[model samples]
Target: MNYDTVRSVDPAVADALEAEVDRQGDTLAMIASENHVSEAVLEAQSSVLTNKYAEGYPGSRYYGGCEHADTVEQLAIDRAKELWGAEYVNVQPHSGSQANMAVYTAMLEPGDKILSLDLTHGGHLSHGHPKNFAGQVYEVENYEVDEESGRIDFDEVRAHAEEFDPDMIVSGFSAYPREVQWEEFQAIADDVDAYHLSDIAHITGLVAAGVHESPVGVADFVTGSTHKTIRAGRGGIVMADEEYGDAIDSAIIPGTQGGPLMHNIAGKAVGFQEALQPHFEEYAEQTLKNAQALADHLQDHGFSLVSGGTDNHLVLVDLRDSHPNVTGKEAEEALEDVGIVLNANTVPGETRSPFVASGIRAGTPALTTRGFDEDACETVGHCIAEVIDNPDDEDVKAEVAEIVTGLCEEFPLYDDDTEGLVFE
Candidate 1:
């Protein structure tokens, strides 16, 4: 996986690039919002189309020489429409966060009110957190999940919405492990006369494959990351009925961004085409099964999962109950040292700082991409528990590293010439 051309151009940059490929090939990527794209997608993302400045939609571009760009972007839009069955889709936003931004700009005024899930309880920062532009511009209120169940409490949400009478109710979560009720959220939005934006960023592929409930036609607006569970290029998409189509497209173009990355659009097109295959459904199912196996095994080791169990591709382990002294940061660092990579996350009733959260979040999307099954995921769970239980023990780390090595060997990655972007 040597970057020969990059090495000839810049040795230092090439070294870093090659090292990243090695890192991914060797490590267990358990980050729920991350996944591995095919070599075909990688090639498309690195194509010469990067040099082209396509400033608008197909056949309506603000620039010249957009023939290829039109082809790629339209292909992406068509494939996405087919995959999600959306009446309209815009594959422009650079990220999921940006997709949320586009929806907000299109639907609400500056002082409009928004009701969203609390950040510590599985919501995204863009939902209403003070740190984001959405929070800065709009008056925001938050709803809570059922503390006892670690799931959304619709009764509370309805009550909160009734009082707040928000202009929008944002659904979708970053670290939630249970299946959400999209229709119930839509009902709440209806009663309150608010727009519904379902940010299915983490479960894009699952929803597309029918493993998770579809928010496409249920919500007023649906947004997702093209990279996460979708395994597409690095970008965001907004889907809605034909009524919101023009507004979203305008908001994305002159409102938010200027030029689109045609290369990434090409990648999105290629990956979406790949996802339409029958095997992708099998992949989505295995992703859920592997997550369930991991959650069960971790619970068996006395680790407390946020909701007692998971119905999706991730598990939220609140370390407070199992390891009273270990923070999620400590657990994450320990696991990473043993070649297992995930993230520290906040739990429902979080007391610790967000930087050093009360919980660790792990998912199966990347490992499932690497061909890992339930038994292998259970082994991963055992290794994770052992390491978190003994972070400073050299023997434990060495043993876990050996196990990770064997797993990587069995499910090898990029066994082709796609190393450092040389795809063939």
Candidate 2:
């Protein structure tokens, strides 16, 4: 919170930091995989614990001077276990991708077949993208969504699993806007004798807050990012049944990574504590409500939303019909010009490349965190619709930008007593 210190060291860098904060204060952030962390979480992330090098699990470190570091690490692990009802947790993977990698290292051999959702549909890169380690090291097979429903086709998943006889099935996604069918995934994995790993990186908070059904109860392994919806610092966690605890811990510590980020683990502990609060349920419910409201507003204004609408915090907008002349990249740029932030995304069966996607992905997590409700969601939806409908209209963009500033004024984030606490 002390800008004076940073300014004395490097004035230019300080100016840039202030400018970015000003921009965030004026705009609407709708990226589904991003959220606003609480002051406590940020404090823990920037704490002195970052100076330590804890090489092993709590109370069993390979190095000395880790007594307090061990306590922080154990706190993170204990909180994660309570949050997800898992028997064991490894709070050391640097990211969700690394968490998945650790699982593969623990369980699978090279060239083992793995079944996962197709990347072009809703799956993430770690879920077996050809260029990723999972694909390079394992034989990968994919299942697609139902073209009509825009949801996973369980029958297709089962058929592929049976034929492929995969050693593992990775279930979870990045952009699909509906609830995961964990029961179907479990049944398919059972039929194929495959280990089930659910990467709930995007929905970890929803699961913790009881807004979404948790896959932890049924999955052999569950991986997640503590940030996304969980509102933690930037880190990843892996939770498993007791049967896989030793393998997972060894994989994380020796197979993939070295010393853990103790400060980030402290932040994760704070976030898990926040998730346990009674009001977190309300926050998660409102997050979904805001998304549904925004989706409906967009649809009413003639935008085509993937999966009809969202049951969670994100909505994938297919712009092919709404703005045939505008690519997702162009739409994103236009919206950015008007103080709204979102990401370009690929729609299923799209002819366009990922960089110039045919669709835009928007969400309500950050906005809802800042206290935006259904009414504000509707207004924001109209603003996006206007910008996308007229990407080249500078006057319209300016008007929408003014409206966005006004909305931010109404639901200010970190503007009161907590203004400087984010850096504390």
Best by lDDT: 1
Root mean square deviation (Cα) for candidate 2: 1.8
Off by over 4 Å in 2: 416-424
- Per-residue CA lDDT of model 2 for 148-183, tens digit only, reads 788898888888888899999999999999999787
Q: What is the lDDT of residue 256 in candidate 2?
A: 93
The residue-by-residue lDDT of candidate 1 on 1-424, one tens digit each, is 5689999999999999989988999999999999999888988999999999999899999889999899899999999999999999999899999999999999999999999999999999999899999999999999988888998989999999999999999999998999999999999999989999999999999999999999999999999999988899999999999999999999998999989888898989999998999899999999999999999999999999988999999999999888989999999999999899999999998999999998999999999998899999999999999999998999999999999999988887876543422112
List candidate 1 stretches off by more than 4 Å: 417-424
Extract clashing residue pairs from model 2. Answer: none
Model number with the top TM-score: 1
